[model samples]
Target chain A: MLGDQIRTRRELLKDADRRYSLRQVAGRVGIEPAYLSKIERNEVPPPGEETIKKISRDLELDPDVMLAMAGKISSDLQEIIRKRPLLFSKMLRALKEAPDHAILEVVREVTDGDW
Target chain B: MIQLKGTNLVLRFPQVHPKAKASIEFMRTLRVPNDGNTYPLPAGLGSFELEHIEDHKAQLPEDWLKRGGVMLPMFQSEAMWISFNGTYPIALKVATGKINAITGELWTNELTDEPQNYVVLSEQPWLDGYAVEQGTVRQFVATPLGSGESAEEQITGEAAFGGIQIQAFPMKREVYKELFESPKLTDEVQQYLEIPAFLRRCSEPAMGLVPGGSIAQEIHKDEYGLDAWDLSAGSRCFIHTVNSEAWSELTDLPMPHKPISARDYKSANIPWFKYYAQDKKALPGSAILQKLKSKKEKPATKREDAEIGQNMSDLPVVKLRRSDVVTEGVF
Candidate 1:
């Protein structure tokens, strides 16, 4: 699924403007073209976080989205979770089934709330 | 179902497929001069702010509340274009004031092929206005309701509605998997396999879209057949356009400032856009739409050219070529 997302975004970008090639993208992200092709085909697992970040930058994709699809959390997020793992785990589980608008309401409240 | 994310409306069909997602955003742009000359694609300044009618039920009319959709504010004579983004293929029907933008017919719930009434997403990125010709579209310029300038008024002899209506249908699951899930199917094979294919008016001040100057754009024919769309699985929404003054009175939100003039934008050397997809086929112009008179052809309303400056003759345009996936990068 991670591979599909990356490949689809790349193909869309290229389709819109003829901007990049798979090989060119791999080269820019410091990966072998064959390896990148394998990743796109879902023949292999997604690359490491650093490589994904590089790819995201080149493709102009959200790094958080890429990292989430790769099944890895960013270090900063991990640090935040480590601070209060139990509370965060409960919050995450509770918000799992909520709709996007409800989740957005929570985000808005937090953003505007007085600490 | 439609979810308001910021200013964009994200339409998701979970029943159809997990990847069935599409977004619609009304982009603000410079209102091209209707001086009897077609122009290039204008730059997208930003998305218009959208608010749910349910949130402001007390201020809006009963009809709008019953419609239960979103609304945005637009300055008189302001121009807009609809931008679309989809994760997978989607069939979208866009109508302004209950008039089909593609076929120029009264709003219909079903899809037809004799003269396709809808546009397929992922192939068609943005729609500026009515499909007047094979490779040209009239720009959407906002005018006040009851001014006899809206397409709805010109076509149906009434300004009953003054907003946009949209419906989205996702591709069937089996068809999607057959086309996209299999890794063996290349882009070329996918291309080759496919077969060729509003609301009540107002107590509050309202704005309706009218045809402006023509622009070089194409409405791509549906490569997928009619069967590909799951008619059973569809979602529709109504987007009401309110005049800026009434919008502020009702919602208590500040209206967006007027967009830069075409002359000013051209003087700043901002590049206009031109998209080209040689493989895709463009639909022929709609006779009904072609027959309708443009804003320039009719007598100018009192509110038409208050802010519009002199029309510029030439503009700087950037050409966007189709992607070449087959080409390999030189190391």
Candidate 2:
């Protein structure tokens, strides 16, 4: 589920003294307690960029991870694609078509080479 | 509820750190036009309000807290300059949870109008430098961050996204109070700078290319057997927050509904009068600051480097790829 991993990761980060309550965390994060509960239960789609930012902060989860989990493409990556569409497109195509073993080999070969 | 019902409605505007020594001299020190009769401070360093907001609590709105409390309007256009050298861009705690750095305007989206602890979430990459049509001969701007493209059309979301995210903090009131009450300016600006260490700490749980440039990892990814360049400016150069005090006051407001539009920015207006729905009875007619005028230091007769360009003392100077680029138009 979209939120299963966030739930697991958030729990891992929480300490006993700082145990986060759904409502407390939700209030700080600007979400409904029920909404955060739904998020933890994997009962809803991941939130938007702004909400994901709040949730990640409230849960002590990495915001980028939460954003990624929520499937939000950050502005930085979007700009990279916009600037070098040809290179990014080719790189994506190569990665998509390459087998794991071949990709590993290419990775090995590139690593073995010096800058 | 106006919890401050009987309390004084004291509103403060940002002023330069009275004690911090300026690295620059002979430049425009005060943002507001001064008579140039005294100490030459750095120009456009931070914001200042001649009039502090002071009124009875009864004047405030009933839903003041709900509407995000009294707001201190920010002038994002007033850029401040700092001189420092770091391979990675440093983040300035312009406000709580909010940071102005070499890269971008970092913030959280809590949407509170209360005196929220500036929960600086992340300096998401907003802008980057493309190999400009002019190629490697890119010159720097008076301000380093914000808007790299000179042309207006290229300034869209697609062209502007920098791709990094940061977690925020709902810091205790004391934390924000410490920041607000602290000296507003410092020469060692890096002390107030916070690195988005979260970006460095988390690995991808799934597939994604590392958005390249001087992001947390991309700076060092090269020496660690990945792709990177010597883009980190060698030394003695930095990305400084220009109009920093506005950013400092921004922490007290609710999150903006949209990205700050420079076209719509009202720089000359006072914060209490503009953003907040309530009105002040009259202007303080805040007299021209006599304190900044007290010094007898005469304007340099043979003024040193009176030119408008930067006065880079003994510090080493170099340029590298910005950690995150904000297009302030071609320099």
Candidate 3:
């Protein structure tokens, strides 16, 4: 089931950018090659919400998509709601505080949630 | 940036071919000040600088000898007079010293350690009009853009009548070298000089590239019978980069960060044409429709009048709005 979700996310990313390679994605997420492969293959359940966020950030994937895929919808969504109130608040925060576009990509995940 | 007060005239070449050469020549003429004393300057220059003396009593060089000199018939910095005509009621807080425009004498405690001495005008002064209150009037200051702490805040009040003429008397080259050689003044002047040159250089080409004003777009209509507007891009202006000569010299040493500043070229308040489909049924129809639409073009809008204030020479000598509105407080 974990492998199925990882593959599904990877396919979505592929649709966004056909040329984007796994190593590029891994480098962006700051995860080791073996660890990323293990997670992708379902040898490990989805990494914690932090890791999912880091991956989403590095890959420029919408954070909401990552949260939905990682099954952290209820818990992770609550954490962001508690911290930053206002719709598109995360996007606003990312715009000011994030250092680079990579940081924006990760924060974007939570901002553009399932709704 | 330094604001130079003077009438800026674009010498129209009714039908001159090769625009680039003509433009370059036009810029060169301004450097030739009206004073007969000449330095090593190009014989053939485009632009020239002129000084308006006080009520026909200017200590100018003789007419035949000063043939090369270009004299502006009306006062330079006419914008100040024009803007002053529509200025609001403002209390002028004059600095402790007197600035006699006729003598070019600046007597202030700050000038000399002994609490009194005069310093001659060393920089080109500009008509810097600052708004005392919105929808009322503006006050003019004789701020030599780079010489002041900040260009925006150095404005002094205008005269009761619309006109106040000040001579831009030239200072000695030695004085300029002494005043400007300092690192701070050099840096400020360099930055100040860059803008006018940039404006002159970029105005034609930049306007040519962008259909209306820096935003690229095509016309389209809405679902309703009415023509709906579409904006291709918004909130953008050209900023000179490190590669530009104007920016390059400022970074001769290892700097903390890049000093890149941009001024807003166009805004919503300023009028701009928008694209709209002539027929509402089609998107970007065959006739790429465009309409000149301005939200702030009404008579009451102050900005439209302010723009008209800038082109004062072209405007008819209309009676200033509410002339009594400001003068009542003074009496």
Q: Per-prediction DockQ scores?
A: 0.01, 0.01, 0.00
Query: lDDT for each of the candidates?
Result: 0.76, 0.28, 0.27
lDDT of 3 by residue, B54-163 (tens): 11223322321222212222111111111111011111111111231111223221222121121111111111122111111122211122222112112232111111
**Per-residue accuracy of model 2 over B128-153 as CA lDDT, tens digit each:** 11111111101111121233321111
For model 3, report DockQ: 0.00
Winner on lDDT (1 vs 3): 1
Q: Order the candidates by lDDT, highest first — what do you get?
A: 1, 2, 3
**What DockQ does predicted model 2 obtain?**
0.01
Which of the predicted structures, 2 or 3, would earn the higher lDDT when compared with the native? Answer: 2
Q: After superposition, how far is residue B216 of candidate 1 from its true place, in Å?
A: 0.8
Q: Ten residues in a row with the worst lDDT in model 3 chain A? A: A106-115
TM-score-wise, the better of 1 and 3 is 1
Ranking by TM-score: 1, 2, 3
Going through the candidates in order, the fraction of native interface contacts each one reproduces equals 0.00, 0.00, 0.00
Q: A26-65 in candidate 3: lDDT tens per residue? A: 7767788788888878788788877777776665667677
RMSD, every candidate, angstroms: 21.0, 25.5, 27.7
Tell me which residue pairs clash in candidate 1.
none
Tell me which of candidates 2 and 3 scores higher on DockQ.
Answer: 2
